[model samples]
Target chain A: MSTSLYPLASLPQIEKTPSREDGIPDGLEEELRAYGCKLIHEAGILLKQNQVAVATAQILFQRFWFVTSMKQFGIGDIGMGALYLASKLEECPIRIRDLINIYDLLLQRKAHIRAQAMASRLASTSAHPRTEFKYTPMSYFGNTFYELKDALVVAEMQILKRLGFNLTVVLPYNTLVNYLRVLGLTSREDVCTKAWGYLNDALQTPVYALYSVPTIVCAAILLTTRHLGIGLPSAPENCWWELFDAEWEDLWNVCGYIMRLYRERTSEDHTRVMGMVAKKGVRQWLEEHRPAGGEGH
Target chain B: MSDSAGPSTPSRKRSRWDIEDEEAQLEQAQQPVKRRSKTKSAKTSPAPEQTRSSAAVEPQRTTAVYKRPPHSIFVPPRTLHPPLMPSRSVYCYERLNSIEEGSYGVVFRARDKETGDIVALKKLKLDEEKNGFPITALREINSLMVCKHENVVGIREVVVGDTLTQVFIVMDFIEHDLKTLLTTMPAPFLQSEIKTLMMQLLSAVAHCHERWILHRDLKTSNLLMNNRGTIKVADFGLARRYGDPVGVGGLTQLVVTLWYRAPEILLGGSTYSTAIDMWSVGCIFAELLLKEPLFQAKGEIELLSMIFKLLGPPTTHSWPDYHTLPLAKSITLPPPQPPQLRQKFQYITAAGIDLMSRLLTYDPEMRISAVDALKHPYFSESPLPKHPDLFSSFPSAAAGEKRRKPYESPPAPVRAADYNLLTDFDP
Candidate 1:
């Protein structure tokens, strides 16, 4: 009674490969996915200021793209949707408006850092609606949260459908902590922080799609150790990844996809962000099936 | 019924029952194959051609199906959701008895085929506009999976039928829910019994809160007592992780049902925490003592007034942030009323009243937590709380057989039983 919940069809495991057959053009898949991942981090940066991990949100964004291809919906719509669902799942329920407001603020901060005065002003005014301006960032976001007010709500349904309604998202963060302890890095605060960062970044990749949870945990640890020039006891004696039966190659592949994103930031946001998002019949389908706003309770 | 019958009867070349038989046959034929490789033994029939022939019959009957659902617009998905890998346990079981209709779905006492053990089968129904299964069910499933306290209702596995549309969440079968017992029990429960029940309820809430989960909907109907007198918290449709993600824009104004809703939430406080569950537990405690809801108001406003009249108006001292909360300022305060717990519930132990006041304290931070309430002298004094296994007065508990009032009403209609009684999970 508190929230609208519509049961949907269970989603099949989509092929991990990004291709035209999966909806988005080959290059478009990588570009839009990168934009989606950026949006998640932007939300993450906002959450981090408040001391909340964006792992749940990132995983949701990754899972959403996997289940529903980019061709069906735009990157921004799913990104906003992931943020909305993550807030609730993370235990701090935020309204979509708050997400939009905070995102606007973050985008403004980013623009201010780059000294882009117009973008910053537009961001600031919209983020603070009562501060004497009304230019919302809806068009910039392909009208995701702005034009489609319940886009998050609709995307939430799509997520549940794809997940077989399984909302349990196991991020590598928790398992990474255990793995960190096993590798004697718990005392090395700086090294552990580096690992945690990698783990957060890994959340945005297809790591979860490619391997199990502990395996990703190993990959994050591996990336952290390699980046920092840390050494580990070889093989048989302290073969930690083997403890979880995780293969290093599978872990490397998780690292590969994430490492590719480091170069994706320079891509044009407009090409990836703007596009038709509400899957063809989704709006009319929404109009017909959308539950009334106020619940009986 | 006639309007649908007239048009569909002529359109359907076969009788309705005939279509149903075909559907059942289809289920039986595909059951093993649906399992893919796991149930190789069940897939003795290599009749792929026969399977296709029967599946071909499905489209016609499905098209001619009734658009009218008696109580709701229940259009099961015409295009099935793609199936994920087959789960180990598909819900292949026989329903033994109807337990009751829950907040969202119909619950049944069923026999789990593989284990040959009794379990509660919650079957979700499509809600209005035929938007598929309820997300509330998903919430409950996810919540149950994370929590493993003895006092929490545990989901065994998600059991889907041959089709993804028809599914059941297998859960531990608690013999009776508090609502059933409270409504039907013939005698006043001994104080010890009350203590035992409250202890279980509070423990469950405390455990959930510890894990950062809030059982937002905590009322009599959601508390189920097993035959051993152990009451496990059931129905997490409204429950969610409550601490970190709470920020300015994403907070939900909707919360617990009217009677059990906390003052802070009712007063428009959006950042309500686990204290809300304590407020509900307080209401449930009052119900156990008084045999009715503590504040059964006609609406939210009335409920607020009733609470204020009972506990006194919210003051800066009582609720430090009272004036600061947006909702508290929305309405003018009614004339002050003195606290009346002693006058109203005099029959309850003074210690019990002491606990009640603490549980319902206006200041959420100042309110008694489940952990603290469990340690209250009320539970320790006089008749010490009975071990759940030894205590039994809750309807489904074995001892209940000696004193439980038999519900004379025939089995209530399943879906249309009481919409208000329905919670979430299934649409």
Candidate 2:
């Protein structure tokens, strides 16, 4: 019997603020941005091969952070490799050889050739010398191809269960970038920058695997236009902005820092455009005309 | 324009988007800097000093492209070096400059104030910041305080002043954990070394069991040795008194690590006895034999499945009263499968594998006790036993003699014949 899977709930909605009054601790934005960059570098190296193992590893690291403390796992380095292992168990298997090569390439930028040689030497003693590693629990998982496949299935199911089964809805960062490409913004390295930023921010927020569809859409819109150099699109007609006001407000709350960064990167102040941005206009109207100077009665 | 029109609510929502300025005000209010602080001083104050050190040391040690807000210790900067502590404290133990943090606390190689001899002073981090030293930690400290075994990590003194700030449990600090030792080995441990470790672990656990204490978290990370081959179980954070009532909920499963978690605990069996620790010994044995975790699980669910798959399903007949526990009903186990150890661990010796399986039984009643397990024939054969006197020169052991200079050379290696001697000593 097919079971109806429940979507993971997003964290409680928090309204966005004006005037920077909420006190974003100084430097928290920069820290998260830096974290975003490292994650991109790591994911980019794996995605270049389009290998399932690498992708799974990257995603697994992302998922692990949703539960347990991420501080202990190098903020997600080892977690990347673990995702690769999980991917190997999933039907989306990639060659271990490709994993090591990508891992080497990722490190090669900063690692000396000698260090690469040592890491490579350690990498070579696996059963599948061309692809596997010395310590992979492959033998425990299987010797035969069929057994390997079965083990992968087991590992996938376990990982899903372990992660609280927060799947079904996925936030595809790469897909949003592709959308930017379709929008004629491919030349810029910064295309859909806010989208990627929002996607990453969504991962850390409590509602990661759930309640993120609208956030994703708004981010895609903001990031695409920011990179297109036309700036954020003037609010669309038919009040599409209001149709998504609730979700947009949720997005704005979780992604206030990211939106600010987008504004900072694009050379347009959000406040200067508040009169033009429909979503912000509604909040401004409410704040200005409300009794008691809009402070709660 | 549609405000006075009937059935215009949808139209108003649509027009709201037409006028971009309406949403613009909302966008202007989107800055994140104004959030009020959620931190309570009661929770923030009295955090363990080690945590503070790890935080402060980050900016000094690396280029640190990320400047994190001082709150929310959850996020670490990319490319962080594990905090490197000086061997001597800036305060009391002031002769060393490089100490390493361990599972329970920090240890520094320092000279004793009264005695000029250099000793490793392990200051246990048991403050409230460390969740106020869980019951397991108390057992480790209280139990080790009474233990005089040579194989055990020795507790020198419980340094207590008038206040909680002044308390620090001092121990004889060793150089490295077994995890560190195995990392340095060129290959997997030779059988002799494995046997030696088994003997040492059994001796210590047996010592603890005799004194009504259990070394709950027995793993390579918890076992430390000096450059010499003397093995001592280090962290007592999870060690607990065997007969003590469940002092707190959610603690029985906290003793052993995920990989080393016993079947009973995995099956949601709580309110355990010393056998819970024997299960950890079983895991360590297999890990030592295989050079990795034996029943490796991605997390708790799979870990339990791996256990049940290897040890067969646990039934009330096997584990009496297991179903009565609060979480037992929550676990839905698969049908029994005869554990197939030999097929999996082909490299391990038949005898060695037998001992491991026995120690890892699903039923605590069926699991081998530390004392009886130590008496198992495994240790009777192989490499010969070295006299305990060889470790007499251990600085802590020799505290009485005219400060005999500490041994700088590496500890002597154990050979396979040590197993032969065990067999000869056996029937």
Candidate 3:
């Protein structure tokens, strides 16, 4: 009932990674999660959702994957479902048709980029002219569009059911703003903007699900101040993070996660992961891990 | 620990001590029932063999059958997990009767088949929603979860039916709604009883406000009183979190019921806050004294006129930001006159009148907050608020109990004119 019901220390996913139990490699699991969260962010932008709605969607997606696994559920379907559900939770309702079209467009865009990357690599190797790729939008009357729509609805219910219908997600943006004002840093536009940017970037990882709002906000502030070389009031036993109830270790840990997100070779990881999944084909991979009843279809 | 769920469990299942403990740990606070604690203990100490045996003997007694793994999403393909225990099917409860229908949902009195506990099941209306789920219902559930207090109605769980459209919100069933109680009673609540009810209402409102939630709709109908005399604030469909930006389009103008609506909302103020809920509380206070809605106007214009007549026209001194409202310029101000609050409630004490006036102040900034209202002298006067336990119980109309006619009372008057004539004749 309380927002702090699942503290950072007590979350089941934080306690034990579910993907690992499903035989997924640790590094690959982390990339898949980051990619899934990135998909939510991109889908949110395509759907023209507000930051809170987008953040809520990202957190829901992360929370869903924490309990479930990529082996069983498709990230694209669940990510779209998270956004669709978050739009409703945050009182910003996105129509099913618009959601489906935008998601389709996003997936196509990703495929197009991958195709371009492959074409460039092949051209460089064989000294052949790179091929041009023209993208076509999904048709309203197409079977694929209708099928995607059905998948979205089913995925939404699955997400809701899996998450136990606890749809209220407390995002750190509000906390960041509040903390900034309290720390007398609101006037510093650079610090405020940087902290906010850190929050947006932090969403790429599982920080939102694993860390409390105050901890995340404090981490953002710490990261922002360090980046800008801004001095904050710090005396023995009166540390600023301590005032916000953020532990010293947690603040640094969140910062480390955000930094790792930047240092990771995301494109290379994405290529390898996609190639790994591609060997079996996405459909066949999903089919192999599908639960007996095909409940989420 | 098994003793907690033993033979005595049926009667002593939801003891007050359990509720107090649940409330003490607000973060993990769930229903007063013993299922959660039982599950928690079962998880830590593996007594599953005994639990399974008990489950076999008394299938309905053990809620362990409903438990799924804490983190697994596909324990059985499509089942839910801990905390959101697979929402038991709606068929788990037997419908007693329809309670009432609201714009957002329909209420029904139902009995839990397993526990035989009575609960109020609110079936959200999803058929007309073009949007996947109504934001109002989401806000209601969110607010209810956030603002959990004894004075606030406790939401047990959400149960689903055969189809998604048949979602039902299970809440602790109270015996009577204040509106029905007032209409049926021969006499209005005594001053002490009214004070007690107001205190309970104010406490609930204060609890919600402290959590940054606004119960935008507060009226007599939304107040439920149990046989024990405890009153709980209910119907949070119009409730939402405030203090943050209301988003791009701004908050909706339509919220509280017409009779209980605040002046700012009626005058097209888009950026209202907790003050609006305070205004509704003030109206409810007056309704308790008068045994009817304070403002029974048919439309916005008429409601505004009624408000102006009762509180006098809003002056520059009373409301500094009156001219800033969108619809402020459309109205012609009446000649200034003093508030007729004392004239309306002729028997109310000076302290009560002062408290009522503060709550009904024209300026939102000047309106009394629930926290401040709780410390007001009105509650400390002679004939102080009665304890909830001491308050007399009435026949529960919700349970279909017919009200006994008032002793030696004349036949009910058919209309206002007849009532007025009878009063005049008696005088």
Candidate 4:
């Protein structure tokens, strides 16, 4: 028998972020990633995907950017591809048709929101804070629809290749719940809800790829308890994080990243980042590099 | 001075600018330049520019190896180099012959071009894929990685073809599957040989369960054997990780082949664990002994009848939750009768009977686990398991070897009377 490739000890490591090397401006990579993760979350909800699948898709999207540049690939195509692949991995498969339609719908909704924001700024209206927007689904038989479909297929393979077929992602949500139960903190509604929110927010960052599941879980719990002003045993001899193989340094690092995610959320505008990176979308790039008679059909 | 200067003038000019341009182009071709060193050496004597450029590029290539951060949690300490490279193309291996096509994928016996090593390649069926990549393939790959053991088949790597539909999984090629071995062998395996095969199978199953994976489909055909007596468990297409809550929709009922399926599954049980795999292991155990499948019935009803005949009807004592099953209300229970295990295998030792009976128990909770079965006294009894290396080898049918003919026997005698001869003799 051949030696095992992906022993727990030797799983693929978090790669160096190539966005800076590819000349993407500082802080923009994080904005693009957050935008991409949001795309996965909204599309996942629209398609009725479970939390695990959505979380897995978010991690895949973050990991893809670790080796690839946002300038080279569009966030929408890669985000859709990640969701499509994650659903399969989690055993809750969504048809590609449904996936494409929902993804296009979400993109249109974002565009509508952005257009309204632009129109309101132009009209200089401060009275009307909210405007009702109705969504019109894209035509299934249009060229744009087929182009997106082809881009989705190509993006799936591109993500698979860029990630080196290491599709197994161990999520920390289950670990967090189990740890809470072990600590006899399941009944603490505030702590559970806060920790759950922290875990969801952590997906928008690179913490999922950078740290182990236990460390992430510990960070979430630690941050939640501190924020709620609830105390847990932290004495050196009986510290809780050590039981889950989480060091103090790693836990703090994870907590800091998660905190930064909330602190920096105010500056990122979706329309500006989308305009900056979506100049040569993944679909256009695919069409330019597409072989004359490829097998995608 | 003029003779030497005239010959060297153009050459010196070429080396100044042209060599630098060539070096720039070579640097953009990220693959290491070692492959072109031989051609470079062959032409370097004629052109000094070629020699100078080759020397300059060598040192730059060597420094290109990536270094991980000191405190990086992603890179494991033991691996000096991780497989960050893209998957190799499927063309790297030449297809020797087609192996059996399964529900999830089609397998082929292939030879690696560089290594000349024979490997089994399973090409996933993506042509009819409507939901993107299939979950079965994902589960199979994930479980195989998590449950790596000496007794389990090793997955080499995943390679891809030109199109999206052409992903292939490379695995170690084994000589025979136990099902074909049983039918083709001249005689049934001796007790000692059976013990060795069983021990290996149990070890593999125990390894999988230890890692929280369930090989939902376990049959003789999925058990691969080498020329030596070692058996490696293969075919994890139906395998999956099982844990608390058993995922969103719960476990599916459409798993494990009908003949090897556990009773609870046939009775519409949705939540199952390692017990289901243990039941399949029991079916495989029976097949190994009988030299055929234990329950060869055509349908689920007939299979249940066969199982009832061998292990007796399920009573409250045997299966406490039998009536709680979804299908329990529709089907009526058979009349109570004793198990026919002793009658079926009268020659087996007491310890052997005990182990088999424990494996084929009516209640899944009562079924012996793979780890416990490994410690059974039957293995330590007289005529113990033969050493895998000491066992004789047979020509592999998968390699296209002809079978050896068995010795001829006398024809059966025709009887004039159809009645029982023993009763006539007594009268």
Encode model 4's per-residue lDDT on A1-297: one tens digit a residue. Answer: 112233121232232356665555546677778878888998888888999999999988877876777767888889998998888777777888888888877777777777777776776877656667777776779887788878887788887767667766777777788889998899999999999999999999876765567778999998898888987886543567756656554566567667766653432265566544353643343456466666765
DockQ of 4: 0.10
Runs off by more than 4 Å, candidate 1: A1-165, A173-197, A200-218, A230-297, B1-91, B96-103, B127-135, B161-167, B245-248, B330-337, B393-427
Candidate 3 wrongly placed segments (more than 4 Å)? A1-23, A46-48, A92-98, A118-128, A131-133, A140-147, A173-198, A214-260, A263-268, A272-283, A286-297, B1-88, B91-94, B113-116, B244-248, B403-427
Docking class of 1: incorrect
**Residue B426 in candidate 4 has what lDDT?**
80
Candidate 2 vs candidate 4: the TM-score winner is 4
Question: How accurate locally is residue B394 in candidate 4, as Cα lDDT from 0 to 100?
Answer: 83
In model 1, the Cα lDDT at residue B330 comes to: 73
Over A1-297, each residue of candidate 1 has an lDDT whose tens digit, in order, gives 011122222223433432244434444465556556676677767655232436666666665655565546756667766666666555555556667666665545443433443444557665633333333455545655455455555665556555554555555566667778877899988888988887766765655543556656777787788778888753332445655545434455556666665763432344223322224423333345445772553
lDDT of 3 by residue, B35-140 (tens): 4324433443344335333433342343334321231121110011123224568899999999888987899999999999999999989886655556788788
Superior candidate under DockQ, 1 versus 2: 1
Q: Candidate 2, residues B1-427: lDDT per residue as tens digits?
A: 2233323322332333334554434333432311211121112233322332333333333323423222112211111211111122224444463356766566567666765656555555545432222333345555665455777888665543333333345567676666755554547766776777788888888887776666777888788776466889766766655444543233445657888877667666566777877888888888877777787788988887777777677777766766776677888878766777787778766676778888887677788888787777777665544433343222222222232445767655555578778889998
Q: Report the TM-score measured on chain A for model 1.
A: 0.68
True contacts kept of each: 0.08, 0.00, 0.09, 0.17
State the fraction of real interface contacts model 1 keeps: 0.08
Superposition error at B304 for model 3 (Å): 2.2
lDDT (C-alpha, whole model) for all candidates: 0.64, 0.50, 0.76, 0.75
List candidate 4 segments past 4 Å from native: A1-18, A95-98, A120-131, A139-149, A177-193, A221-253, A264-268, A276-297, B1-85, B246-251, B329-333, B401-427
State the DockQ of every prediction.
0.05, 0.03, 0.08, 0.10
